[model samples]
Target: MLDAHLTTQLKAYLEKVTQPIEIVASLDGSAKSAELNELLEEIAALSERISLVRRDDNERRPSFAINRVGSDVGVRFAGIPMGHEFTSLVLALLQVGGHPSKTAADVIEQVKNIEGDYHFETYFSLSCQNCPDVVQALNLMSVLNPNIQHVAIDGALYQDEVDARQVMSVPTVYLNGEVFGQGRMSLEQVLAKLDTGAGAREAEKLKNKEAFDMLVVGGGPAGSAAAIYAARKGIRTGVAAERFGGQVLDTMAIENFISIGYTEGPKLATALEQHVKDYDVDVMNLQRAERLLPAAESGGLIEVQLANGATLKSKTVILSTGARWRQMGVPGEDQYRNKGVAYCPHCDGPLFKGKRVAVIGGGNSGVEAAIDLAGITSHVTLIEFDSKLRADEVLQRKLHSLPNVDIIVSAQSTEVLGDGQKVNGLVYEDRVNGEVRRVELEGIFVQIGLLPNTEWLKGTLELSPRGEIVIDERGRTSLPGVFAAGDATTVPYKQIVIAMGAGSTAALSAFDHLMRLPVAAKPELVAA
Candidate 1:
């Protein structure tokens, strides 16, 4: 089932495996088992260093054990490793096959020192872009410490366990049968959790209490870029975010970030954080900004109230909270979310390659997603609620040029259909004929619109009708010292390159604002 291009890439990657790795597949008489067996066989054929063994086990059918040729690291997968989980499989094989772990030395030391017997059960969805990082981290840690065992579970395949655990989101990790984390977590964070035997709540306490000259809110590409730029100017820079990556974590492939030809969302996010850390930016993760109080007087300090009951003082604030994909809110949409219903095509499209898929909405995003998926997926059905598509003429024409794409207009998506496991089809209403129809497909991509992350700024900052913060050419808001960038602003297009540029503009504007202040009134620059 591997494409020629992907096959080549796999061969090159597998060449780095110095030690032999074995994949022991426990199979039952099920289609999911067959699919996984086929995938494993294909991967094994890529290199002689890898081997696949099958066993007819009834208890854990469709599960697999990944073992180094001689050493057993106790790494296992309870479901088909497709979508984002596919990366986990690749990385696990590499790690077990003698590839050195990339985790930092400090984190490795912490993992080595972890005392008690801990079994990490990470429940993830095939479509979740952030799941692989958490899974891979745990898997690597398991290899490093014999006391730690890691089991990666596909939530879609194990609905019973998911329901029992009340797992509402992907990348939900459990340590010793208790909730550990809900989203993407760095190795340091995981180690800290293991060391402290506490959850993220313990780490939310604000450490740096001093004032900052430039405080960038949000930690997406824009905010990270702004923080980096501001810190380079030798100013007191700080960044506060609920999570570092923001919506970038949900994104999959990124080929449009100028100069960089190819990269993934997680890779870019790591680079963004590292770049910010390279400077003196005070990064406060897991901290949400609840309220923003503009300075009463020009050049006065601004107060930012966080959800954790911590108030931060800053000379200037740049808002770059970014935006999230709009949901359909149809029946089964939420229930089967991340199962087969996904919001990001770039992240999950590869999982559905050679499978039938449907795209909701016919705007630029939807049409573009359809066009992009047509190259990987066997076929794509684009559904539009209006009589005609709302995408740009150029994009519509480009979409029509694809042979594997079908356009359906005047159609309203009514519900997502699943077989209690994963998405199997989508139900839509034919508005023109008043008929409801179900399209047989394995996945559904929703691309209706993006809701900016400026809801908290409502009634405080000057906002547009669409709830985006109103900004001038210099990325300045109506408030003198406050600025905004990225999708949270009135920018026309929402792209990574555009957001980075906007971030730089906002940082420059903030710096300009800071430079105009009197030396006695300016906040002292503290070395990060």
Candidate 2:
């Protein structure tokens, strides 16, 4: 199944294996099974220490497991691990074969010490960008601890099972036959759920840390830039985030990042994180800031309290908390959420295969979603609140050419219709003639816009009427020694490049603010 170039790369990567490994296939007499066997044989042939064997024991056909010769490393794939999951398969091979993993030492120990048996099955779409993280993390855990076992299933190939479980989203994980989580999750997040004491331990660690010269309040592009610039100044810098990637994790296509002509959202987010780690930035993931306490007086430390009761202090703080997906507040929308309502086409589009669905919005996201869904779903009805579509002309032309797609401009989504189980239809109002209409469908995809993640800073910081943090050209907030940037701020045109530039400017401004503080107030005096 792999091409010559990919085969060469896979062979080179497999050389990291320091011990013998076995590939056990649990496949049926099917085309997919034959293809998987071919791929596995090709992989085994590339390395002398690797061997393949057929063992059709698992009920899931076309599946295979990577096991260390003398150990019970339980990492398996339920389909051809290609597409976005190719890296996951590669990592599983190396890790299972006794090759070292880059996971933190503490985290590795924690995984190895977990108490109970965990059999996790994750359903993922091949096109999903977020699935690989969850898959790779769980696979690594399964390899590290025999108590844990993981199977990454391709939802498109295993549609029957996916439907039986009512999995409407990608990366939907089921542990011991129960829903565990349903999105992009890091290793720490998974451990925090399984190991109840992990949060308390992390909170305690944060509370005991020395005050940072600059503390970034998010880990998106903006927050990463701020942390990097501050760390380069040879001062203590820290970053705390609810999730490292922020809204970018849900984003799929990113064509306008400058220099890099084309890239995916999760890929860019990963690159941003790795770049930040290359510096001295202290990155704390899965930390949600509950409140902010401004300095009591000039030259005092700013305190940021997290939801887990941990408090972090800093000389100067940069607020780049970023924004989140905006939802359509129409009636029944919340009731039908996840049952048939979704936000990402790349992640959830597979579940709606051959079914009728509706796309709500007329912007680029909505139009692009319609275009993508048309290829999977039976039909796509695009409803827009505005008089006309706001998408680019090229996209509009492509959307118009799709036979299964229909556009409804000047219509507003009013309600989501469901039978108390799943979405069966939708209600809309025709703006042109003041008429109400209902479309019979099984899904609704909302692609409206973004809301600033500045809700926590409502009363603490000066905010614009639209809820964005108010900042000057130098990225200073109303509070002294506090600065803001990114989509969360009042920066015109919320773009990634702009957010990064703003973050750098805010970090520089924060440094200047600290330098002007009283000599005793400085964490350590800079040469200036």
Candidate 3:
């Protein structure tokens, strides 16, 4: 049940409800049901226009549906919507109770205009920082279109269903009983998947837009910062990113963001996005840049081609397309991905509760993942390709103290073993003796490393051997009027604060480059 502070906040929020709402509970004689019932009772107590009803018709026990009294608009939760999902629950309650959503009007219209049946079920974990976005987006979709029905299910509570469905990732969505997606997705992303013409329409709209003074190629911390800084100079700034949050959406925790002592990846990404939006930045999310074409002559317009065939022109461009998690390229790893291969321990560890799992790394992330998994899983096998763990002494000590964790150094993952449906074990090689060993595990969490998202920039910009954008100290790339920053650049430290600073530096450098351009070349582009 919500505590006093949360109850007060919920009561205040519920005061905005303009229509009667119904909370129908599907419960059984179980401890979880009792807990859910108590939570529902407390929720109903906070609002005069809200009422609770007891029902057991749902196949998923301890579930509940929030419905508007006179409409088909409703959303369901199959477990206690707490932790990161608490915001999702609150938003669902308000949205179903006639409170308006802050989603863009065009997007809401697109959702309402959708014609087909979409029964979406999102499997989530409480500790997952990314699940709420997918859950909330689908919840809003269901609220907008009566044909769309969505239920957010907690994988930890619905273990049997997760196993049966072979779900090995958080926020894994199923639309009409088929896999829709398996990561953090915004409302626009969900709409793009549903409305077939959405991408074309978006591309057409983008094509007609005027050119930008500074265009950012990503929307992570670095790109957000660059967009904000560029827009603050009273110039036309736009950000075209595949996803607004970039790889940060997959990240879980952050303890070293300067002033902020503690924060989550999604939270920081959201804040960065909002801050960028506060300026005159045109944030074009879910846009993937496929190619970059520099200006034909000095001080001319630079063009960026998107995957959708729309070309974005700018006086200056900043490339901040961040990196993604490195995958174990061993055999069967790709075939069994999401069947058992995972990246984030905070997200998928719950799905393997009480099952033996393997952590394939010895770095800080791997050791930390093992330490985190040791608490939830029956046992954790930490496999390191290095001679010793590269984690901090504190983390290594904590990992060693765990009773259910085993550390194996100088071992290389060779293959992932599965029973055609789900992972059953793993095969590795001892680097010291060249002996092959197989460990039985239900899941494998790969914490190996990250690879720069510079594949698209190949043959377009000067890149390091490791695929990072080669940049000078001032954030200027090898190409004139083109800059780079963040994890995709040659920056030594790939931290949030460093990325932000580099972003600002890149923006400033781009502005300087613009000012120093031929005075005659600026008028035509600026006027258009």
Model 2: per-residue Cα lDDT over 1-528, one tens digit each: 889999999999989999999999998889999999999999999999899999999999989999898878758999998888999999999999889998889899999999888999999888999899999999999988888999999998998997788888888999999999988898988999999999999889988999999999999989989999999999999999898877888888888999989988888888999999999999999999989999974337899999999999999999999998789898999888888999999889988999999999889889999999999999999999999999999999999999999899999888999998789999999999999999999999999888999889989989999999999999999998899989999998888999999999999999999888887654877797
Find the candidate with the highest TM-score and give its number.
Answer: 3
lDDT of 1 by residue, 56-164 (tens): 6636668898888777574889898876677788888888888888666856777888888988998877767788888998999888888989989887677777666
lDDT of each: 0.84, 0.92, 0.92
Off by over 4 Å in 2: 297-299, 521-528
Best by lDDT: 3
- For lDDT, candidate 1 versus 3, the one ahead is 3
TM-scores for every candidate against the unseen true structure: 0.72, 0.96, 0.97
- Distance (Å) between predicted and true CA of 230, model 1? 0.9
Question: In candidate 2, residue 253 scores what lDDT?
Answer: 82
Greater-TM-score candidate between 1 and 2: 2
**In candidate 1, what residue range of length 10 has the lowest lDDT sum?**
198-207
Those runs of model 3 whose alpha carbons end farther than 4 Å from true positions after fitting are 297-299, 521-528
lDDT of 1 at 132: 88
What TM-score does model 2 achieve against the real structure?
0.96
